[model samples]
Target: MKKPKPLRQEQILGELNQAPSLRVAELARRLAVSTETIRRDLDELTEQGLLNRTYGGAVRSLGTEPSVTERHTLFVSERERIARAAVPLVKDGRVLMIGSGSTTVHVARRIAVEMKNVTVLTHAFGVATVLAINPTIKVIMLPGDYHASEGATVGAHTVSFLQNFHADYAVLGASGLGQDGPADALIECAAVYQAMVSQAARTVVVADRSKHDRLFPARYAHWRDIDRVVTDAAVGSALAEPFRQFGVGQVLA
Candidate 1:
C-alpha cells in the first residue's frame, strides 16, 4: 500500500522529534522510500515552516527557532545563575571571543556592565548592543552575513575572518553536548564556533540543563576545546567526573 504524503510527513516529524535531526539518506532508508522522494518531502516541510533545511537534512523546528528576546524568557533564572557563575572566570584586560546564544549573551551582559578595559570579538549584534553601554570595554564586531532572527553574523566569511586573530578566552554556548563538547543545530554557526575554539587560548562552554545529553547535527568542538563548563545543577552526575578527567572544571550555578 502506498502511504499518503501527509502521513509520511507526519512520520518524518515524529522521527525528528526524537532525534532532533535527520540526514536525507537515513530518513530515506527509514521511510522505505527513494532518496528523491524524501528530499521532496523535506522541501515541502521546509516551505511550510515546519522544519528548517540544513545541509543534506532537516531538523525539528517547532520551538528551537525563537528569537533571542523569546529565548531569554525560556530559561530566565537558570541563565541568570549561569551568567553569575561565569563572570568570575573572566579576567580583566584580556582579549576574548564571545559566541552567540542567550546564555552567552547573559555572560556578555555581565562582562560589559561589571568588567572594565577588556577587548571582545564577537559575531552577535545582541551581545554587542548590550555591551554598548560600557565605555571601557572594547567590543569588536565581526563582519559577515547577518541573521536577524539569530541576532548574529554567520557564514563562510565570518569563519574566514576569525582565522586571523587570537584571544585569551572564548566563551561559547551550545544546543547540545556530550563527552565531545558543544554542538549546534546550524552548521554555519557551528563552523564559526569551531574557529572560536581554535582562535582562543582557552574555551569555556556555557549552557543550561536543557542542552544536557541532547544531540545535534553539528558537534563543533572536541573535549579538548572545553577547559571549563559553567552550567546549572541539573546536569547529569555521570558526566561530572568525565568532564573533570579532561581538566574541565564544572561550575554549577
Candidate 2:
C-alpha cells in the first residue's frame, strides 16, 4: 500500500537537495505518515551521508562551511518568518547589537522596515548599511579586519570595540546548535558573537529549525547567555532542555 523505504528516502534526498533544510514534522504531515517513520528515514539517510540531522530538521552535507552568499539563498521563507517573529523582541529607541549571517541579515531588514528610533551596533557591514537607511536608526559600525565573503568584521579589533558600549538587546544567529549551546562554523565569528552577548542586557537568538544538535568549531553562547530563542518551529526536549536549564524562553514563529 505504501512506496518502498528506498523510494521514500530518494524522495527525501531530492527534496533536501532543492531546499537547504527539511523538517521531519512537515514530511510526516505531507506524506500522511507518522513522525517516527520520518525520523527513522532521516537516521538511515544520515548514516548513508546523504543528509545531516539538524535541530528539528535535516540539511544536505556539503562537507564544508557554506559561504554567506550561499547561505542567503537557502531557507529564505524560514528566515523571513524568523525575522518577523523576532522583530518584536526589539522595541523602539533601544540600543541593539546585531550579528552577521543570513538569518540576522533578514532580521536587520525587518527591523529597518518595521521599527524606528533605534541604535544598532554591529560588526556586519551589511547590517549597518541596511539599518543606516532609516532616519530614525543610528548605526554604529564596529572596527575590525574585514571579511569580504562574510560582509562583516572579526578578530581582536571587533572584540575590543564591543567593550566600549552596551546594548539593550543583542540579536544573534547561529550556524549550529548543540546541547552545549550555540556554535559557529568560523571561530573568529564566534569571538565577535561572544562579545555581542557579553555587552547586552538581553540576548535573543534568531535561528531556523535546522541548527539542533549540530556542532561547529566555535562554541559561543551557553544557554544562560541566551535570553530567548525565536525559531520557525517548536523544538523537541532534546534541543529544548538546555534552554529550560538556563531559563531561556523559546518562542516558536
Candidate 3:
C-alpha cells in the first residue's frame, strides 16, 4: 500500500505568499514535498481564492505579471519627465515613503540632492543605497524577500514593516494606469503599494505618459487612493480626465 501524503497546505501557502508565484517543481523543491502534493495544495488554495493556477505553477490570486525591472528599461525618457514633475513635492523635515522602480530611483536621486532632514522609508535597495550616503537624511528599509531584478524587497515582511509607520507623503510609481485606477506589474508589489497608500497621509502617483492608458495584470489602487498625481504634459488631456473624474488632484510638468 502507498503511504498517505503529509499535510503541507500551510507550508505551500507560505511559499506562495513569499514568492507570489512559483512553479510546481520549484514549490516541491522548496517545501521538500512531491510535485503531486504541491499540485493538490495549489488546487485547494485556488478554490479558496487565495491562489491562481497558471500553466505549470500557481501565482497569488492578486494577479500574475512581469516585474518592475522588466518594465523599467522600456520607457526611459517618459519616466524622467514624470520624475522631474514629482521631485518638487518633497518637503524638508517630513516623513516620506517612496516605492521602487527606475523612475522612483530618479525621484530618490533628486530627493537626495534637493531635500534634507527627511525620513525616507523604502523597500528598494538601490534607493536606500543611494540615499544612505546623504548625511542629512534618514533612510529606513523594509525587510522581505529580495527581488534581485528589481532590487527591492517584497512579500509579507515588507507589508508588516509598512504597517508600523505613517508618512507625511508617499511618492509611488505604477506599471499601468487606467481610467478607473492604477495597476502594477506584480501582485506582490501591488500589495506593498496599497500598504503605502494607507500609511501615508498624502499619496502621489508618479507615472509617465506611456503608462496612462496601459493596463497591467493587477489593479492595486483606485483613483481615489491617490491624493495627487504628478505626470508629464504628454499624458494628454483625454487620459487625464478620468483622474479628475475620480477627484484626484493632478500636476503636469
Candidate 4:
C-alpha cells in the first residue's frame, strides 16, 4: 500500500506545480507517509535539482518540468488529433526513433494501430509499451539512467547508444515551442532528443497549441533541424515564418 520513492517524489513535484510550495506535514498527511519519510524524499529531490527545499517543505524548482502523469492529463483531445495527423507521415518498414513525452505516447498509440513491419528505437517505457501491442512492430529500447518523472531513460549512455544506428524518422515532443525551436525542460532529455534528431533522416515535432511561444531550459533543435511540426492550431508569423524559411512542413492538426 506504500508508494515507491520515485512515484512519491513525482507526486511531491506535482503538488508543487499546483501550488507555489507545499509543507512537509501536509504532504505527509496526503501521501500517508511519516514526516521523516517525507523529509528524506525532499532531500533526495533537492539533491537531484528537482525542487528547492524550504524551512519545512519544498518549492517548485525554477524551470522544473511537470511529471509525465501530470502532462498526460492536459490537452487530451488536441494531442490525439496531433497524433492522428502525424502518424500518417510514416511509411511501412522504416526505422523510427521516438522521443519520450505525453504527446509522443499518443503518436506511438496511433502508430501501433495504423502501421506495421516498422522498427522503433525509444528510451521511453510508455512509448515502447504502447507499441508492443502490435505484433508487427519491433521495439528496441535505448540504454541509459531511468528518469522516473518522465518515465524515460536519459544520460550520456543513451546519447552514445544512438550512434550505432540511424533512423528514417525521429518523432519528438516539446515542453515548449518557440522561434528558437522545440525545447525541453530537462537537460538530459534535451541531449537525447538532440542526438535523435541528428541520427535520423528527418524529424517531426509534436506539440499542442499551449506550448507555442514558450521557452524552456534546453532548446533541442533549431528550425533548420526540424523537418515538420504538427500542432493543433495555426500560430502567427513569428513562429510560422521560421518554419517556412527553413523549408519545414507545418501541419495544423
Task: Compose the digit string of candidate 1's lDDT tens values, residues 71-172.
Answer: 664566778899999988876438999988889989998888779998899999888988888999898899899877678899988999999999989999
Q: Which pairs clash (backbone N, Cα, C closer than 3 Å) in model 3?
A: none
Ranking by lDDT, best first? 4, 2, 1, 3
Model 3 bad stretches (over 4 Å): 1-74, 234-238
Cα lDDT listed for each candidate: 0.82, 0.83, 0.76, 0.88
**Compared with the true structure, what per-residue lDDT tens digits does model 4 show for residues 1-253?**
8897767876786577567789999999999999999999999778766679999999866665568876785567789999999998866439999999999999999999999999999999999999999999999999999999999999999999999989999999988788978899989999999999999999999988766776689999999999889998887777988888889898989
| Per-residue lDDT of 43 in model 3 | 85
lDDT of 2 by residue, 1-253 (tens): 5667766765675577458798999888766678899899898767655478998889877433566775675567788899998998776438999999989989999999999888899988778877876899888998999988788999999999999999999999987777888888888899999999999999999888666556677888888889889987777677778888899898888
Which residue pairs collide, candidate 4?
none
Backbone clash count for every predicted candidate, in the order shown: 0, 1, 0, 0
Worst 10 residues of 3 by lDDT: 1-10
Q: With candidate 2 superimposed using the best TM-score fit, by how many Å does residue 217's alpha carbon deviate from the native?
A: 1.3
**Candidate 3 residue lDDT tens string, 1-253:** 3223323654564465457579999988877778897788788667654468999998765433344554454445656666777878766328999888777887788788778889999998878877876799999999999887678889999999999999989888887677768888777888898899899988888876545666677777888778788776445565568766778877876
* TM-score of model number 1: 0.73
Q: Report the candidate with higher lDDT, 1 versus 2.
A: 2
TM-score of each: 0.73, 0.77, 0.69, 0.76
Model 1: which ten-residue window has the lowest total lDDT?
A: 62-71
| Full ranking by TM-score | 2, 4, 1, 3
Model 1 stretches astray by more than 4 angstroms: 1-65
Which has the greatest TM-score?
2
